[model samples]
Target: MMKNWLAAGAIALTAGMTTTVAQAQSTMIPGENVGLATGAPLPEGIYAINTFIYRSQDTAAADTAINIPILVWATPFVPFGGRIEFVVAPPTVFTFSRVAGGRDTSINVGTFVGGLWAFDLGGNVGVSFLFGSYLNELNAGRGGGLNILASNTYRAGAAISYTGDGYNLTANLTYQFYDTPGRFDGPNGIPAFFGPVGISDALNIDLTATKKFGKFEIGAVGYGTVNLDPNILVFPAGLGVAPGRLGRGGRFALGGLIGYDFGPFSVQAYVARDVVTTGPRGVESTDGFFRIVAPLYTPAAAPAPMPAPLVRKY
Candidate 1:
C-alpha cells in the first residue's frame, strides 16, 4: 500500500501544481515557427492553424507527459485594420507516472482563449499586447489527482520584436493571476485525506534569437517562471512533500530551435532542458516539441517596384 500512497500523494501534488503549469503551457506562442512576436496579429481576413506535439519527461517524479495542443489564429472582418487577432488553444494531455513499483496513466483536456493587438513601429520593429485566460473546468481526470489542467486564471502580457537584415530578436513578458479553488479531493474523492491547497500568482518571461539562412532559421529560446509570493501556503505540507512542491518557487528552461518556411507553411522542432528546478520535489523535465503552422489565405500583394534610376545626360 506504500506504492498506492505514493501515487496518491503525487496525484494530489500534481493537481495543485497543474494550475500554473497548465496556464503557461497553454500560453506558449509557437515562437519556434513564427518568431518571438507571437502576440502580433495577423492581417485582416487571414487565418492560420498551429498544431503542437510535446513530450516531456519529469526525472524527479519519474513521470512523462505527452501534450498535444491545437491553436487557431484569425483576424475577423472588423472595421479597423488587421491589427486585431484572436487565438484559441485546446490542449489534450496524457501522463504516464511511476507509482512505487508500478505505473499509472491519466488524460485531460484544457482550453485557452485570448486576443492581441499588433502595431508596427516602423524600422522593422513591432510590438503587441495580449490578454487571455485559461479555463480548467473541462478536465475529466482530476479525481485521479493526476490531471494536467489548471483551474481558472487570467493573463496579460506584451511582446516586442525586431527584424534586421539576417537576424530576429524577440522578448515577451507576462503575469498570471490565479484563483482559489478551496481544496483538492484525492482519488477517493475525500478532501480530509488529501487536504486543502492554494496557488500563487506567477511572472514569466520568454526570449528568442534567430538567424535567417535562406529558407531555414536557427535560434535559441529561453524561458523562466517565478512565483510572486514565494511563501504561499500549502496545507498539510509536512507529509514528506517539499514546501514549494505545489508551484510556489522558481523554474527555468533553455533550449534551441530549428525551423523552415515553405511559402505559407512552416515547421519547427525544439528541445529544451530544465536548467533550474523548483527543488527535489518539483519537476525536472526535458522537453521536446514539434509545431506546424499554415496560413489559409492568399499572399498579400508585393510592394510596387521603385522607379528606374535616371540616366546621366552627357
Candidate 2:
C-alpha cells in the first residue's frame, strides 16, 4: 500500500513538471547578430534588444540543452577614437536533457559574461579584448554546476575588417584559456559524472563577409576551434565510445545572415548551419540553428567642419 501511494505521488509530480519547460529536445542555434552593420564608428549611445537564442546542442536523444539570453549594452566613444563598451545578460537559462527525463535531468540557471572593448587604429582594423564569465549555482544536482559558474573566463584577440564601397569582410583569431578545470562533486564530496575530468587551452578562428543591396544585405560567417592538449581530448572525459572521442579534436560552423539598415537603427536576422566538424572519428555534433539581433543606435550630430584651416600658420 505504501509503495502504491509513493508511485502515485511521483506520477503527479512528473505531470506537473511540464509547467517548468516546454520540450526536452530543444534545437541549438546561434546568438543574434549584434553589430554587423558598416562596422564604422557610431554615435555614442545605448543599445538594447532580444539578442536571440544560442543553441548549444540538438540531438535526437532523449535529452537536450538550450540557452535564451537577453542583452543590454551601452557604447560610448571618446574623442581620441577609443570606445568603451558595457554589456550585461541576465538569466542565460540552461536546461539539460528532457523535462520528461525528470527534475534530476536539470542542473543550473545563471548569468554569463557578454562584454568586450574595441580600440580603433584609424581604419577598419582594431585590437579588441573580451572577458566572459559564468555564474550559475547548482540548483538541483551535484557538482554545483562548476563549469557553469566558476571563475570568470578571459580571452584576447585581434580583428581586421574592410568596410568600403558597400562591401565588408572581417576576420578574427582568438585563444581561450580557462582558470580551472570546472569540476563537480557528489553529496559526499566525491567526483560526479558530468563534471570535467581535465581541460586544456584552445584556439579559435572566425571569418565573416557581407554585401549591401539597397536596404537589404546578405552574407555568411563561420568559426573553427583547435584543441591543443591531447590528454584533455582523451582522458576520463573521453566519450566512452572510441568514435565519440574524436569529437573533441575540434569543430566548425557556417551560416547566412540578412539585414536591413534604416538610418541610425538597423535590424539584422541570421540563419547559420553547422556544415562540418573538426573531430577525428566522427563523435561530434552537426546540429544547425538560427539567430537574430536588432541594434537600435541613437542619433548623433554631424561633426563640426574644420574651421578656416590654420590661417594664422600661413
Best by TM-score: 1
| lDDT tens digits by residue: candidate 1, 207-305 | 777777877878888877766655445534643555444344556778898877676566667777778756224556666666555545535778999
TM-score of each: 0.73, 0.63
Ten-residue segment with the worst summed lDDT in candidate 2?
11-20
Backbone clashes in model 1: 0
For residues 160-249, could you state the per-residue lDDT of candidate 2 as single tens digits? 555555555666555555555555432212113343434445566656687778767778867555555544432234334342232345
lDDT of each: 0.50, 0.40
Residue 207's lDDT within candidate 2 is 65
Q: Positional deviation of 10 in candidate 1, in angstroms?
A: 34
TM-score of 2: 0.63
lDDT, candidate 2, at 68: 39
Worst 10 residues of 1 by lDDT: 5-14
